[model samples]
Target: MAVDQLAPPPAVPGIPLLGNALPMMGDVQGFLVDTYRRMGPVFQVRALNQSFVIMAGESANRFLIEHGEAVFTSAESFGGLDQQFNMRVHVLRGRPHRHLRKQLAAGVSRDLLAARWDDVMAVTDRTLRSWEGDPALPVVDRFQRLAADQLSIAFTGASSAARFEQLRSAFELVLDATITGKWPRAVLRWPAHRRARAEILAFAREALEQRAQHPTGGPADLLDRALAATDENGQPYPPEVRAGMALQGYFAGINTVAYLYSFMLYALLRHPEVLDRVRAEVDAGGPLTFERLRDMPALHGLVLETLRVYPPAPGSARTVTKAFDFEGFRIEQGRRVIVAASVPHLLPEHFPEPERFDIDRDFAAARKASVYAPFSVGGHTCLGAGMTEVLAVATMATLVRRLTVELPRPERPLRITATPGPNPGKRFKVAVSSRQEQADYST
Candidate 1:
């Protein structure tokens, strides 16, 4: 097949060097959607001397995720991540990627998570209690802190307040750098990034040393488990490898979980009816156990709906490795292919009235059809998906049951930031009161 004979997907023309870089940084989802409307599901857009072939909608999603490995590679797609951090599972490819994912999955396995249920509840309760005196608390900030503390406990066994702050700051910098794809040329030479990385590494090294000396009777936390993990050949991972894996897991859980918790709250507050139904389910169910969380259809639906509407990570990219024809267009090898959750989640074909937040929507069918991939799809699906859902449901149930949340500005829309994740730009303040206080006032 002659390369010239094959047609390239439509490309959005832009400046000579920068191309659509500015627009992409400004409004990534909007830019991709607009281009999709104009050029259909498969089109190309140039950004900073590179061209990306974006594939949207259900078919596009299936092709990009399920069948991606055959024609695409994750390492090349996420190459920029190397500049920020060591090669984590997300940025690894082929056999190494599979091995790393398998090792990491042990940390978030259903049984492991169930064992730590009490720890999760305790942290969440502590966080909520600390906010009791404040009449109006910023939901995002509070949740971010809560998530950092919870993850620190689950991943590292224990973390001081100072360590938690350091981890949060470091994760934020790495996340921002990866999303923007414009890190300072010197990379870790920047004082803040350098300091943050050093702190994270120091913490990881200290935790590893402690685990090695004590050899906790049982796996105390994810770090301990990773340290003791052996590959298929029964070879233990090096100390640095274990530390890097632990740090990567910590970074992954912190920001993503925080944003997910915030979005779930935002969605529930905006829809009081849904909130009431979820609370009723929680009350009737009694005790927010893992089983109870799974049993409550309303609460489960709300979490799924929140993810569908405001996915923490909106889109993912892959680098084409083999020439393939997709939907009548011939895509050449070495092109960057993007599959956006925002696109399929908002498609009228997959989701009728896609923008509307309806918990009762038929997500089961949509998921089976590959239209709703909030945690992503295919070979690289997030290992933390199950854990995040469980924790979010449990936390939200506790919130509704113990306290009443009142949005100070119900009329104001929930605005998201420009980053790939569903981070809110404005602070979400809710005038919260105890359920007992509300009951007494009503009487």
Candidate 2:
């Protein structure tokens, strides 16, 4: 590893000005995977005026995951977060990030979802009930609403659209402008996004005030536990920190739920045999408990396979605080980087018949070996990964067990909308052909 010269990563060929931004944005996964094939794991691409070094494949993944803390810092790329929120969870770096994660984990933990399992099922039931007479319903919208209601209830003890919609309305715009950087920076001042930002901050203030007064300690909701969270020194956080951190948990995975359900349902429509297998597995498994869901390999594989085929996000953006060399390429300090975390899913070396959707493929082995980390690993891993998985798996199971439906165009493409997060575009919808009665899972 010593004595070799390190050079800058190779850059993708692109026109002047816009650079590779158009193609990359138009078909991100395709562009990343294709460029990876031609340029190898370590390379460069420019988007608008911004440039990024793309790190991908197995070795690249290992380097990033194992040494991410040493080489990278997300605090800058997340955009004006400190001034607006007074706290950092996802984008903070080093000791601060670790300490905050430990604190926030309690509020956004998977166990919270388990404790509220009945609410999840009931929410699914209500959403399904709403789709009764509709011939064709957009799975994306239906599922997004389902996730919003469930998350709102889990975080704030409110599920009705009237209450939950307060958190969701224009949330995507605010998220894109503030967190994801999908929208231009100037978009933040657009009257609609400005209103959304104000509403969000106001909602957090009201929620904090209400929760502080009530403090009705039964099972702790997100805000209650978040309010009680302390630092590594056992010091309580400021009100702004408490509110911002807790609110992040409130609307974490609506997009994932929307896309996951849409793709899984779309796949089920295209492959009837797989549908039969899933239905059979679900029917054989009597109660839909958290423990039981974990044991069902068929369902687990289905979700995993969908992720492999259609990841909600192809990669994540970060800024390099320290220079690092990978595959003989020197990633200089202060460079923007895109970790194409899911790019390995396209490599046949890691996955046999990579295009084929075989749920039984040993993805567990790949995940165990650290060659397939969809939610990322290490200090900057997604805090709500557990919460997201539980919500997604349960909703999918509940959907499969309850009703039968049809996708009008099983052959329709899975066009992705990357803003807010990647979801199947509205054109991806299913026609409900039948219904089932409300379910009572508790005995």
Candidate 3:
């Protein structure tokens, strides 16, 4: 129903200027969940000088998925996100946005992964193999690097793996700041972050130069796709321009895949019975392929369950360009709208025994019902989402098949740190053993 009245949505009472920024920053997901529950689906939350109209639950998800493009654009909502870098697809709208997204789409697509399957497994096998050497493992660090290496393999080719390994900290810092916004923008001024900025630009330049040096018709990665760009003038843009534009492709996740992997491991280690079931499922599957991996019910279920319990970046924010009305409340133009997608994940109506982490639950059906959007919805749905699904299932299966991992304190509940998004905290370290060593102990 359209409302001509200028009455805003119910306000979430907060302090005058700073508003709810402190609590919002402290636990963004928790704040969102609580506010949604308390204030109902549509409410206004102010943070600092900003006031955001938060739309929660399945209704919000559908609204964004269906009508988001017409009413919202991310440019202002995510202003200054580009920072030192020039343009990013996340902030663009209309033709320019679609153009860049199309270019980025193919490189990160599932098809490219299938085409480069050998390198994908090699990187996976090598990374997991490295984990066995670490007696006291920080799965977060290892998974963070693994994600970067995987992106390198997917984009710049496997030869850049060593280069990526050397630049791991740079990627971590850059992605942590850029993709996740976990660190305040001030953190970018640090000496180390400056070095990180240099390293990323250097990495981009080196990848471009190497491509030129040996122009083999290899499977086009994201970098290749980015370099393929031509301006509206129909002339190729300058190297520096393309490199800046292509920087987003190098993302390895601060809170995205990095934390997702950590949480998956945390969940599995927490539930030994589920871990054993997954291990058995992995064992029964002779050779793991995407299709074969999906056939492994327990493994698939574990992956899905992990996502439900610990979504890395659960909410997507957009700025309203044109005013719109929803549920009798009029959200004005220039308002910031946060689609609180995580709310439905824990809603008892959708998820029975909402707090329990059970593999038997059907989150896919929940997702089908528009209540679970782990990768989010609308024009800006995550590009790497499909790749993440395959990586999650494949990496978890591979980890269980080749190695055994144990938490230091298995009985202790997980403590989360929002490095801008939900992540398993520092205490979630693990002890690793090769499967052969484990078997020897059994023998």
Candidate 4:
């Protein structure tokens, strides 16, 4: 078979069964990019005794995600997500999945999100003001705190949201356990691992039980509504299912949101001019309100650009359930195909001057043409993307309006920490004030 006709197996030429596993396992993105450079966009790699074809570039990714939905299954892509959380329904494929997705979408409509802006901004303002005195706090942790708090408010009303501190500790343990477990040979039964897992389960159990028994009315947060949802047959979810949904809320909401906020802060620090430009746009609108925020294009560009440059979850994969042929090589059933997001995100075809960070570059036109998809694509596209974006924009816009921020020095070029994230060690110190020095710049 000609290599050009079918997808070539990700190029793994040497080493037997566990070919390229050791090197690739530790740094998946780095290994994928390196392999692509050494071979081509598509190549074969063996990890854990399995030979899987990895795809790169925008067209390849689109073929796998958008066009080849039947061949590649998200259930396989996010395999252990169920093991980590109880909300198996949300991640499940087919009828139940579609129904739940529709319900979630209905609940989180644009109008609902707009109505929640007051609460979102209130949480953001309070959180930012709390960090006023600290001129040198690590932005990652700070952003994590802010995001977690906002999520707490967004999901569980203001009065109930005060428990975010407790939730944060639980979430941290969950993230630590999950990330560590994903690494090879890390025993989940280890004492530290067991303890972390227990913390997560305990937190989920309490939150679910509390929300289930005592329901809050008026703009249902994720928790209250999830607890109220019925299965496909119009029956209440089983106890396990209910517990699963609650756990999913915590897992889905915290770490990813933290990553988004952290990346946004990293972008602001790295690109001072962009930050200043965004601040100018916000300042020209006068007082920070939900109405003005939705109109700020520069801030919108900042959010969009940040995600394009440093996506929180850099790669999303799907496994082949059926045998298929691509670029000439036979892709056997059950093999995984990883979409290399970090590389594709930088593809010059999709994003011109892919290496450069420029917000002025017109993405709206390209996005409409299916050139950009940071949230991943197809049925498995992120459900919380809309909420996360609104939160990021709201928080960032408020900070710019109410605060004067200055990076002591330009942030170092971000380095990958956990495959798809910026390591927090490279902290950028920024002096922040409650009031502006001068309103010289205007949008």
Candidate 5:
């Protein structure tokens, strides 16, 4: 039977050739969520002369991401990646992807990251100083800048303090170019875009080469580790591959950590009471010490809750490698499937009163009823989850330890950006004051 015949009909009709592309192009994330409600979890959309099957809901997401066909590959999604990231190695599939992943694991082991805790603390302290006495500072921007600096120190040992603006602008430009639906070939060939690409690549290559020559032992950052890594064949990558890894490492850290920080800050800003309670808990729990940071059950609960609500990578799209049976449906080879992350976060069975941002909600008690995956699941799950937690604890603990952010106008709702963010829109004008003054601003 034909794949189309076997599968359910598309959730919505398209404009013949255009399919559902134009509406989606306007707002990608919103489009996906809204369509899913109308069409159900699995639906079809066509764009750029290709048919894409968007799948969501917990069961569908698990089935698609966990099950793969020989022909299904990440290659398609990553093809344009080279233009933006200068990455030559394909994360698509097969030996090459596994080799690179394993080598990276060896390079940025948990122990290595743990050793750099002092550096992270130093950067966090410096960032806190930036907000020391500001009467109306935006904590969101501060968090973004802080995370950037921390990532700089953790990844390249570069002091991102001075270069945060430049690094952020360059990254934003790259993300702005890539995250939207596919760009035309003409745009890729444009001299301006080409030049931007070349400049970023050149900068990354220079940094990696410099790091390779002077290795930082002990708590070496990711760059130094990548430079020191070797494949099973005992072969180290050339300058370009090492450079690409370094660039990828930085890219991965910048927005992701920033977004997580933003989400945490947003939660605090939105729920001043929760923020106050958290501050007290942190204080009472102990001096916001690194070792004790994770023990703060409230903060941990908040982190998990924020992640559930605002997953950085909400859904992932991949091409099918082989024909597979999914939920009694025949998913043919080479077709595309999307696994939505947001659906499970909102699923009634998984989260009671899903919209409410209650931190103390028992996630453990709702295990089978919940299939919430913030970092995703399976072998491709995010490698930086552990490091992300450490960084989050350091950041949040630092803020709570030193000062409380006083939102100038706590009544307004903050604006959000169109895409997943390390930096989001709608700044909150806040003041950093001693804990005693927090009561004055609370009401």
Candidate 6:
């Protein structure tokens, strides 16, 4: 194919210097979806003074993930997160990335997560009980904090009230700052960001020191696993690297899990029939045991559907390392190729009636077709996928068994934010009443 014949993807013209940065920052998902509709599967949009080849659907996902290392590089793509994540496992490439991924994978292994079931349940119960007195609560904020607390406990066994609060505060500041994508590396120089980073590093350092003092035979949590983690050369990463990786876990677990949980509830509340089915499954399944949670396929499907509709991280990107032909476009080296994760889910070809929130959607077929990976796909797939699902299942089961939540503004539409995830802004509030109270009131 001639180079001239294979032109750049269709692009939405931009302002003088700003390009499409402002519009994208305002509503990333909507902008991308609208562009996809007008320009087809492949298009281009300039954001933040840089041009990105925006690719939609399953082929884009496969290209970005399966051939990620060969044709693209995560280190270049996620370099912006370097200061926040300290170029941890997620951002690294090649052997170091693989080694770190292997180590982190073992930490959140099925066996390990299964062992931490009691702790997860305890945290969930405590969090739900904490919301008892409140009439209306900001579900996102509360769930974010709850997720952070559970992650702190599950990852580091950090139980001290003061420590947990400090961790939560630091994570909140850091997450809020980074999630908006408004704060670049320059923002790190600000005192607030500096303080948050310092506090996180201090916490991680303390945890590392404590672990060093009291090493165990088996890994108790992610911290311990990272501490004992060795690279391909049989060399353990330095304390700072380990700590940075653990903080990365905290960052991902807290935000992604919380958003997914909140969206799951939002989806169920909108679909009462689905909510009833999930509740019945939970009620009949008895206690929310790990095994039972797995058996409840309705709940599982609900989570998957929620993920498809409101993906926590809606888009991811890769920087082309070597020139290659993708979907007829000659993608040159050094360009960024962006993949809108939720686009495949919304495609009519892949999903019939894509707008409908169907819990019984054929997720198996979707997965087989490479159309439904909310946690991402291929080599850099989320390490916390299993743990995240377990947390969501436990949280839903606990809430459904205990309370009936009502959205104050059920008719209101969810507004998307600039955050990487599908944050429905601050308008998502819910009123909670005990199941007994709700039943009595109905009677």
Q: Estimate each model's TM-score.
A: 0.89, 0.91, 0.87, 0.82, 0.83, 0.90
lDDT of each: 0.72, 0.74, 0.73, 0.63, 0.65, 0.73
Model 4: residues with Cα > 4 Å off, grouped in runs: 1-38, 45-52, 66-68, 74-77, 89-91, 107-110, 158-186, 191-199, 406-412, 419-443
Off by over 4 Å in 6: 2-5, 13-23, 85-87, 159-180, 216-219, 437-443
Per-residue lDDT for 169-252 in model 6, tens only? 555544444433445546557787677677768876777787889875555667777777777789877767887766755655
RMSD of each: 3.5, 2.7, 3.7, 4.3, 4.3, 3.4
Q: Tens digit of lDDT per residue, candidate 3, span 118-189?
A: 677777887787777566798777787788777667666654445555455554554455434456557768
- Candidate 5: give its CA RMSD in angstroms: 4.3
Alpha-carbon lDDT of model 4? 0.63
Better of 2 and 3 by lDDT: 2
lDDT sort, best first: 2, 6, 3, 1, 5, 4
Error of 5 at 8 (Å): 5.4
How would you encode candidate 2's per-residue C-alpha lDDT over 176-254 as one tens digit per residue?
6654556777876778766766777777778878888988665787788778878767899877888787576556556
Residues 1-443 of candidate 1 have per-residue lDDT tens digits of 56547788877778878988877765465666677767788887777746778787677877866677788787765554454455467677677778888888877666766766677677777677677656678887788778777666665655445666776666555655554455544554688778777677777778778877887575556777777777556788776667777775565677788888888888888888999898778777546676666688888888899888777666777777888887778888877777775677776777898878988887888778777888878878878888788878888888877777788888887666655455765466788776773221100
Top candidate (TM-score): 2
Of the candidates shown, which would achieve the greatest lDDT relative to the real structure? 2
Residue 209 accuracy (lDDT) in model 5: 76
RMSD of 2: 2.7
Name the lDDT value of residue 168 in candidate 1: 67
TM-score-wise, the better of 4 and 6 is 6
- Candidate 5 accuracy as TM-score: 0.83
Worst 10 residues of 5 by lDDT: 434-443
How well does model 1 score by local distance difference test? 0.72
